[model samples]
Target: MTTKLPTLPSLQIPFNQPFATGKEFDYIRQAISNGHLSGNGAFTKKCQAWLEAEIGCHKALITHSCTAALEMAALLADIQPGDEIIMPSYTFVSTANAFVLRGGIPVFVDIRPDTFNLDESQIEAAITPKTKAIVPVHYAGVGCEMERIMEIAENYNLFVIEDAAQGVMSTYNSRPLGSIGHLGAVSFHETKNVISGEGGALLINQPDLMERAEIIWEKGTNRSQFFRGQIDKYTWVDVGSSYLPSEINAAFLWAQLEAAETITRKRLALWKQYHQGLIELEKQGKIRCPIIPQHCHHNAHMYYIILPDLESRTTLIKKLKTNNINSVFHYVPLHSSPAGQKYGRVSGNLTVTDDLSSRLLRLPMYPSLMSEQIELIMNTISQFLSSQ
Candidate 1:
């Protein structure tokens, strides 16, 4: 007699589902009717103005992606070859790749185990004469200790370029995450809270950089000034690239931006459900939940948990796969990657980054993620941990 093997469940929950606000299609139609589908059109200007007002930044320029914004920041910062930029290792490749493209060296630091942000305490020790800037990544939409980070930058005469890719609606001490730094980059990737399929913005807090930033966003030309009647014609004034997103993307993003608060609330509610449901597992020492400090007003960009070890995380992922629930692990610490070895150097031991990268797992999170889905995910995780 042959015993039948258990069949895997059909995929029921995906890792993320891009949300659509009601006005997106309407805005796109309007943009098309206006006959300007190129970058820096009416919709793009509206999006830029909205971001500047919302974030209270000196200026905001829409970019093709968060990577483009970071690259623009690198150019605006005037990073030179051999110049060092301090940042945590437990961040996306774009965080390092931007500066690396400018021939700047990335000095990696360890992260805080609680917040998974750059450890503010370790920044000073990494500074040297060649240090040009400090890029603090706000992991999981939780703000970094910007107050301390900014203070350090001031004393060292270093620029603060905030990698606020995951922190669109997040805040630190009531100040917007991207608005505090000299330059901040926000993402509108499909997975982000306010998405336009693939878009980003550069929040320029320093008034001095505003004009140059616009030039850089327009591919090294002073066309923005020319359009504003500040110049008769535009010409390449400095090094830059085609960082701007087209009007279609801007129109879609405008819809999301208009309903930002509602989307954030829905995501937060789902995050809370996951948090409350898994509290017992956290209490039982089976897993660890995300920690948001009192000062941070997070945007609920993601909800993640820390398993006991890599083996445990792997097992849980397998279990979730069998149950048709999609969960995922985050970045491989940039400091440990091949490019990092060639373009960057670790200033201190990335103990927390190394450990967390192996143990952490992100659950499905998006504005469209239903409460029932979250409950199912939590229940599946609880069962897996209980069996372990």
Candidate 2:
């Protein structure tokens, strides 16, 4: 008798898929009819105004990308050569690169083992005279301990720039994630919950910084004030860049922004299902699910699990692939990367960051993901763990 192997299922699940709100085309057509495809046009103002009102920021400037927003932040914070910025090593390179562009030093800190956020406790010890800012990345749309971070910033007179790239529609202590810090940056990449293909926004919380932020968005010119009749003519009064996004991108973003609530609600529902389905595995020590603190109301931007070790994580990922599930891992620790080693210095041990980087695996997460797909993913994971 010949031994037989069970055929794998044909279902294919990708790591991420961009969600459409059904009005992107309509808005884009409207923008085209308006005859202003340039940056900071009518559609741009509409998006900016919506963000300012919704997030309660003093001013909001839409940018071409999150990287642009962070770079603008570095300029607004007046980051100079040799200045130091403290942030977790577990974040995307942009978190450090923005400040590095200004000749600033990145002081890499460890992350919290549970939330995978910058360790708030270690931030104070990392602070030095050269420390100019603290860039706390709100990983997976889960807010960091902003109150403590804010208190530390107040004590040291350091600027706090919330890297809220994944924190849109998420809140901390009843306040929006981006609005709590001195400045905040949000992403609209295709992978994010709300997307504009490649878009971002700079949220200026401090009233003093709003004027300059606008100037910086307009490429170092006071063109905004000139348009508002606040100046005789816009001129090169300060250093700035063309950080604004095209009206087309803003128009597409408007549709997503308007439907943000409904999309978030549906994603949250899927997140809950995954949590419920995997609770047994988490309890049995097979995997560890994401943790949300009592004060946090995450936007369900991602759903990830931490395996027991790197080898186990790799094995599980392979198993899922064999079953046609496209699971993926996240960032390598910045402190351990080549550029990070060259441009940044580690303040303390990054044990958690390194460990989590190897162990964490993000599952399929998107608003458009079907309920049947969610069930298939959960069942496949459960079966794999059970066999282990």
Candidate 3:
């Protein structure tokens, strides 16, 4: 007798899918009709205004990408050559690259195993006279310990620049993720919760940085003030670059911002379903689900599970892919990368960062991911672990 292999599902599911709120086309058409397709146009202003109102930032400037926003923040922070910026190794390269572009060095620290955020306890020891800032990336839309980070910054006279790329509509201790730091950057990339295909915004909390922030956003010119009638003419006044996105992207973003609440509610529901379904597996020590602190209200940007080791994670990922479900892994520790070795220094032991980066696997997460799809994914995961 021949053994029959388990049949795979014909339906395919990707790790992420860009969702539309149905108003994108109408807004884009309006932008086209307005005849001002340039940056800082009507649509751009609407997006910025909405960000300021909703996130309670003193000033908000939309940029072409989160990388652009972080670069702008680096400029505003006045990063000097050899200046060290403290951050986690378990983050996208942009978190360190922005500062490196300004001749700054990234000081890598360990992460809290719970939230996968910069461990606040390790921060003070990493501080040196050359330390210019502390960048707390809100990984997976979960906030870092901002209060303690802020207190440490105040004591050390360091800047706090938040890389809240996955933090749209998320909150930490009742404050919006991007609004608590001296400067914050949020992304609207296709992979993020709210997206404009390729878009981001810089939130300026301190009133003092707003002027220079605009100057940098406008390619080192006072063009914004000139348009506001605050200056006779615009001219290059400082170091900056072309960071603004065109009005078309902003138009699409405006629609997403309007429906941010509804989108978040649905995504949260899906996140809860995954969490509740995987409880038994987590308890059995077969996998570890994402941990959300009591103070955090995450935007459900991602749903990831930690396997026992790298081999198990790789095996499970292959199994899922064979079944037409695409699961993926998150960042490699920046400290272990080639560029990171060249441009950054390690502050403390990165045991957690290394272990988590290897074992973590992100499942399918998107607003339109049907409940049935979630069930299939969970059951597949459960069965695979059971056989292991």
Give Cα distance to truth, residue 53, candidate 1, Å: 1.1
Of candidate 3, the 10-residue stretch with the lowest lDDT total is 1-10
User: What TM-score would every model get versus the actual structure?
Assistant: 0.97, 0.96, 0.97
Distance from true location, Cα of 340 in model 3, Å = 0.2
Residue-level lDDT of model 1, residues 221-334, one tens digit each, is 999899899999889998888998989999999988998988899889999989999999999999999999999999999999999999999999989988888899999999
Maximum-lDDT candidate = 3
lDDT of each: 0.91, 0.92, 0.93
Task: Give the least accurate 10-residue stretch of model 2, judged by summed lDDT.
Answer: 1-10
Tens digit of lDDT per residue, candidate 2, span 1-388? 1111222245477777777777888889988999999998888988999999989999999999999999999999999999999999999999999999999999999999889999999999999999999999999999999999999999999999999999999999989989999999999998899999999999999999998898888989999899899888778978888898988899989988988898899899999999998899999999999999999999999999998899988988899888788899999888889999999999979888888899999999987677899999989888878887
| Per-candidate alpha-carbon RMSD to the true structure | 5.5, 5.6, 5.4
Write down the lDDT that model 1 would get: 0.91
Q: After superposition, how far is residue 170 of candidate 1 from its true place, in Å?
A: 0.8
Q: Give the distance in Å from residue 149's predicted Cα in candidate 2 to where it truly belongs.
A: 0.7
